[model samples]
Target: MQRPKPAVIDRATALRYMGAAGWQPDAAATALLDKAEALVLDAATPRAALRLLPRSALPTEGQGNDLRRHLEGCSHLLLMAATLGGELDKLLRRLELSDIALATAADAMASVLLEQVCDALEAEQRTYFLQQRGLYLTGRYAPGYGDCPLALNDELCLAIDTVRGCGLAVTEQHLLSPRKSTTAILGAADHPVTGYRAGCATCHLQKKCAYRKRGITCADS
Candidate 1:
């Protein structure tokens, strides 16, 4: 059975996410990250009866066009879900002042948290892929990035039962919960992996990258 290794988050990334919410990574935040990591790891380990239907499986011309135009050459789809415990719900309620406010906050936080979680998961998955001489990740390609359609969230939610299992449901507008959760697609290839440059050029928000603006350099030099 395929098991997802533990989710890892660096202190810096945790700080960044907390900062976005106007909250500093106090003792409470540190404690939360530690607990969240454990919870995510435990949840990720269980295998769900899930299938990743390819772009070909989509029925509509618009969807086909969306996949062909955006997700061309994409080969694999990984679907994962976990039941959201009361703790997550409590966190969401505490952070969100109102429905609209919560939605807005969730949109931003979800992307950050998801990116960190996916990075950790992909690192482990890449190791496995390399051991098998199969494929390794180039980088994660998420919806609403590089022309990938955001509309695919519905498909992802259905594929993984994001609502029933994860307590994460997509609104009519397609946002996730815990105000800091995420789902994404990653590109994999059989080629030997190259280290991700910690430079502006390699960044997804290269042109207007906040990390760059904050003088965060991922460059080896």
Candidate 2:
């Protein structure tokens, strides 16, 4: 595991996460977001871990058709976990006690940072496998997408040793702890992969997403 360099958080993405994407921020709101962004950047400590396993090695009991289809034509799966660490969690909690609005901004910024970290990890592995073994990676699919069971997070956590490697934890409720972390699965194939999308089309929350309600998509930001 290697520490990823800090990334500049995208303001639009952060606003989208906060469900305030289209709303114009007043001076007070702008100041609040500025403060929260600074705190999130200061507190964040990015870390990531990845593990590659043969597709057949994964247990089959709970895998859904959607996931199976997503990995079709692939011989191996790449499991990844990434986080902004627990210090960001502590900062968010403290802000929650004093200013809910600021806390909300911080949470959104943290989410963006975590996503950036995951993207970087995925790109890193994609290049590694391509150059080292002539394999290409399918777009990542995570637990809780479509019929993919949320319970799979536990298995994923253990498979990748996310707890010891990156300090990422999976709760009994299937949530990732440090409160700002993510896990994903990517398939490696002998040929180039396609037909995967990360926007509203593939998201399980499509019908209820705040972005959709605003006539936009997460990818828009």
Q: All candidates: CA RMSD in angstroms?
A: 7.3, 2.4
What is the C-alpha lDDT profile of model 1 across 40-107, one tens digit per residue? 33333222223344434533235333233334344454444322334544545544555444333343
User: Model 1: how far is 167 from its true place, Å?
Assistant: 3.9
TM-score (all chains, Cα) for each model: 0.52, 0.88
- Per residue, candidate 2 scores C-alpha lDDT tens digits across 74-170 of 8888888888888888999999999998898989888887887777777778899999999999987888876678889998999889989999999
- Prediction 2 TM-score vs. true: 0.88
Candidate number with greatest TM-score? 2
Give the Å error, residue 112, model 2.
Answer: 0.4
Off by over 4 Å in 2: 22-26, 195-207, 215-221
Which candidate leads the pack in lDDT? 2
Q: After superposition, how far is residue 111 of candidate 1 from its true place, in Å?
A: 7.4
* Cα lDDT, model 1, residue 194: 37
Give the runs in model 1 whose Cα sits over 4 Å from its true position: 1-9, 18-55, 58-74, 79-86, 95-116, 130-133, 189-221
